[model samples]
Target: MSANHPELLKLSSPIRCKILERVNKFKAKIEFDGRIEYAHINNTGRLREHLIRGKTGFCLRFEKPKKTKYRLFSIEVDGYGALIDTWIQGKAFERSLDLKLIPWLKGYRIIKRNVRLNKSIIDYLLRRGDEETYLELKSAVQRIDGYASYPDAPSIRARRQLRDLIRYVEDGGRATIVFMIGLRDVIGFRPNKDVDLEIHKLLLRGSQIGLEIRAIGVYYDLHRSSIRLWNPDVKTLI
Candidate 1:
């Protein structure tokens, strides 16, 4: 099938030397747990990864992926695992998006693929205001110059999520999307229009209508297995 989005400019591969170059520069310790668990603390989360870096590290952020679906996130190190968050990989960014953005959900339910709804399945199910919700997570990897963008790898599933959310809104259901920007050096999350314009248009429409589109900043302390919002204002790039 023909793609409707603009082609993003070429950049370094995900697993390329650039990754090791960045990781090796860190003098901090490593902390990452390969096992995935159920995301119970938040409504839009399914699993959390424990840091395995000899006890100390924090996430720095993530760069573009060599491919889609790898939990190939970047982290910072200091001494030992602290906040132990992040699970799975490619789809994990979506949860961090909600945890950082959705202010309304101070204490809500986060379930793992409890039930399949439509064409696209959300990683987490959030229940709030008596309505069962679906959520999808994405890692912010691609960027232009200094601008951070989504779909570090092209995702037909992502487009499906957008369409599904559009349908959810039409059906009187609540839905929100989180684009977790793992990069601390960047500002906000923008659609990689070069990669997916349909998604961009749908995202714009979702924002205009009822969909909650949020961009959460990540403060990675890989050595401590911790990530926090370093900025008060979560930026959203249209």
Candidate 2:
């Protein structure tokens, strides 16, 4: 990790807003600048901690025409901000990779983005020498008991991808599953068994079957108003 470029990504036209209520899985009502409006929620996870009423949220104001004028990116967590936007999390991960911040993937280069394998579209494909690895990134914004957790709700898609990765590893192929821990104060990352026991079981099975499991932390610093790469190699609890 380079000392000069610590902040991985900066928010675009960010504004502080108060979360009113989550209208649905895709939309949330927020109050900002003395006005109430709907903001697009990019994450599908059940963010029970961040989406509370009156909780402060950081959002981006989009100039282009869209369904919602604002998009919720991060929410206040113990005076700091916890990034909740899935898109922003992916962007931060890409920036970290480009800067060679992730130590585990030091010699690897991204060959493709959103590559299709079998029936699922994995996040990235990397090559280092003759070895090729299919990598999938999962957002772990749910913070529980000083650890970053995944799938605040049950996700069939995530479960299917886990199965596919496990099978791919079994068939003499290389695969890696990375959990993007989007919090500043997490000790480590782990699968949320309480939310989805099957996912937890599948992750355990995948790790046991030679699937490379890794974790990286990317979080938003409210005081700096920029997204920072908290840790390039966060410990994997599972």
Highest-scoring model, TM-score: 2
List per-prediction Cα lDDT, in the order shown: 0.49, 0.88
Q: Give candidate 1 misplaced runs (Cα > 4 Å).
A: 1-72, 75-102, 112-114, 222-225, 231-233
- How would you encode candidate 2's per-residue C-alpha lDDT over 172-231 as one tens digit per residue? 999999888888778899888988999999999988989999988887878777888868
Per-residue lDDT for 39 in model 2?
94
Alpha-carbon lDDT of model 2: 0.88
lDDT of 2 at 2: 22
TM-score of 1: 0.58
lDDT of 2 at 77: 83
Q: For model 1, how does the per-residue alpha-carbon lDDT over 1-238 read when each residue is reduced to its tens digit?
A: 0022111111123221011111221122222354321111111211122222332222323445332223333433233112213343323343433554445555556755535658777767877567766766566644566665765445677788889888888888888776655455665668878767788889988888788776654444432333444432357867
